[model samples]
Target: MWLWITGIICFIVAVRVIYNRRSGVCTSKKLLDGKTAIVTGSSAGIGKETASDLARRGARVILACRNVQKAQKVADDITGTTGNGQIFVKQLDTSDLASVRKFAKEIIDTEKELHILVNNAGIVAPSVKTLTSDGLELTMATNHFGHFLLTNMLLDLLKKSAPSGVVNVSSDGHFFGKNLVVDDLNYEKRPYPSTFACFGQTKLPNVLFTVELAERMEGTGVTTNSLHSGAVNTEIFFKTNKITDYMFGFLFKLMAKDEALGAQTTIHLAVSEDVENISGEYFADCKIAKRSEQAKDRGLAKKLWEMSEMAVSLTQEDHHYAGK
Candidate 1:
């Protein structure tokens, strides 16, 4: 009887510990009244919450998403809730190179200044290998290459808006992806790994891209960083396997954060004055965090940048703008 009572007490304590734990929050009070910010994949999940938070802080927030209708609805909701009518929706499909270029061109043509860019868009690798029309692996294209091209294309504006920031939402899962062969990034000459492994591979590039871009952007006042949002109950898991979705949903609800909590690190990286000069770093839970060894490889980072440029068919003009 005493043993049973002890077990019950311990169970209650464990439950409380799990439920009461919270992720770090961005405590910055900086207002972005005149700032123009773009958040890709802002239609839902962490991206939506991140965009909403920026809008609430008075930024003219643009929802860069693939689904125009869904993004518009999100923009409306953000405007209604925040009373910041500056929220706008623009179409962007990060998996498609053409769509990335189109979105970048429009932003450059219209927006006079860009203060923040949140490369929060990402997708799960399918169980089977998939390829984009551009002949790159679909997962790599969307999660890394597309953002790579977009950021480079907008390099001039980000630089012009001195002290600007580029926040890449990466993941700790990158540690498992050191096997990423930069030479054959698209898996064209190699065997396709499992979905999770492929997903991990894509995440590593996000950090590598941040490291490389930050180095290239030295003296430009455009800080670039990457982060791992704590596990959250997001829809990225539901779009893949039906059988596993239910299990994942249950597990996530019990162990994961809500979207708002998951957005904290991203928010911190974007608007906080604390990290205004901190670039080429990885973060988690609103604080600087250590990255994987592979993520620290400057050689790999440089190689990946060159290959990504070629894969995206970055023009001489685009290269000039980035180097300028």
Candidate 2:
């Protein structure tokens, strides 16, 4: 019995070693000396690591997060660790359209040029169905709609700063969202089964949005791409119930990648010269990765774009910024 237990432990250790080795690492030494970047939800987790990587590359990074105090703390830490004091903290709650608009306006007014926009802010859906002030489902609103509006609002700036990139942090879990109803994005007609259900549903839009935006901005020099950073042990799970928190904590330590590894694909997309001309593609492990058939459906992407615009109540003025 003891021999069997020892063998099992050895196998688990070997598998973990192999898994971590397979995770991608961004080896680029590219510098972002004059570039500026905004990473939403940067106070912690994958977002925080991504922000730190950008700062280390000499980019002026804005930590756009809902918690100003927490974000400031992160900014200070990045500055101290990277010796890049250009890190700034801005308040942004992606679940709230008002907060999104407010943050976008401040960025446009103060920043002369914008080079990277990482839509990394996200939250796990509550076990119970919930709606935001905008009357949109909480998870969809934060993970998708808010980002939709923010990206369109900042499109002009990104264009003016030619050779810019938008790196959206999507997930492999999008595969579970094959049954997403484009018309019922807010889950009005559909039942919200579980937190996992809502999470997968929202990730689909991240890829679809990238596909459509890439086509729209083809010649504008503003590239858009989405990526799935393999599952990492991040703080997102702590927001769930105690049971889930404990469960994921144990599982993540056993199987998930660390935060720095999780941020590699995002860092690569933001700084890699190889993909300078690449757009509208999904990526994993620092390479162009295949997405689900639905993610590649241009017609569906276009339809979702139109629906999202209306859902966010985007105005004619906002449309002016979106690449026509």
Candidate 3:
């Protein structure tokens, strides 16, 4: 009877601890006081939730979305309802280099600094092999290259914000990625169902970019990180075919989390005082977490970056985000 009572007491303590931790996380503490944040693709899904969460937390949010009108509407609603209207909206299409550069220049000319940059805008176009204006794979171009270019463009501003962050929203799907074919990143030689193979190379690029960025931005007071927001029931999975769709629909029933939970980790990093200086880490479950074996390989990360640069024809000279 004594042992049973001890076990019950311990269980209750553990449960209470967990409940307090989650409660503390969920209360919207307004922790991001006075900082400025730019959340890409804030029109919908996790991005939208992230924007709202940041705004609620006292971050001056800039909704860098492709749709200016929708972005403004969301911004307006956030400010009007919360009574914290410092939110700004700008048009940015992560898939297009020209738009990215243009947006960068506008920020440079207008704003003096940036605090958090969440590379959250991503597109999972269907199985079709669509190409960007620059003729790279659509998903790769939009999800990775676009953010890479944007980050490079805003490096000066990010550096100015010393002790800032650049977060690339990656995925667990990076586990499936293999050794990148440096000579054929665009699938010019082997383009599988762009959608089927999408989860692999795309997420791999995210990790690679984070690793490379952490190196490039060392000591600039800008830390970088990535995360898998879990199996979110967002539009990404909707891009799959009927068969894949039914399978995922069933799978997500067990794995999926709401957009609020999806944004939890992002908000945690952007504002939490403990992680203010933390960088080059990946997160899940509202905490810093480990990735797969492949994600741990710096060699793979370098190879992916080099191959990606070659594929996109990106060079230091092309870093300027000026007109077109």
lDDT of 1 by residue, 10-108 (tens): 875676457437578899999999999999999999999999999999999999999999999999999999999999999999999999999999999
Estimated TM-score for each candidate: 0.94, 0.96, 0.83
TM-score of 3: 0.83
lDDT of 2: 0.90
The 0-to-1 C-alpha lDDT of every candidate, in the order given, reads 0.90, 0.90, 0.76
Give all candidate RMSDs, comma-separated.
2.7, 1.5, 6.9
Using TM-score as the measure, the top candidate is 2
Residue by residue across 1-324, what tens digits does model 2's lDDT show?
A: 999999988886887788789988899999999999999999999999999999999999999999999999999999999999899999999999999999999988999999999999998778888899989999999999999999999998999998899999999878877877888998789787676777888998999999999988988999999999987888888777858766877777777888999899999999999889999999999998878888888899999999999999998777644444
Name the runs in model 2 displaced over 4 angstroms: 1-8, 321-324
In candidate 3, stretches whose alpha carbon ends up further than 4 angstroms from where it belongs are: 1-30, 239-243, 246-255, 310-324
User: Could you tell me which residue pairs clash in candidate 1?
Assistant: none
Q: TM-score for model 1?
A: 0.94
lDDT of 3 by residue, 60-112 (tens): 89999998998888898989877777888999998887888788778888887
* Backbone clashes under 3 angstroms, per model: 0, 0, 1
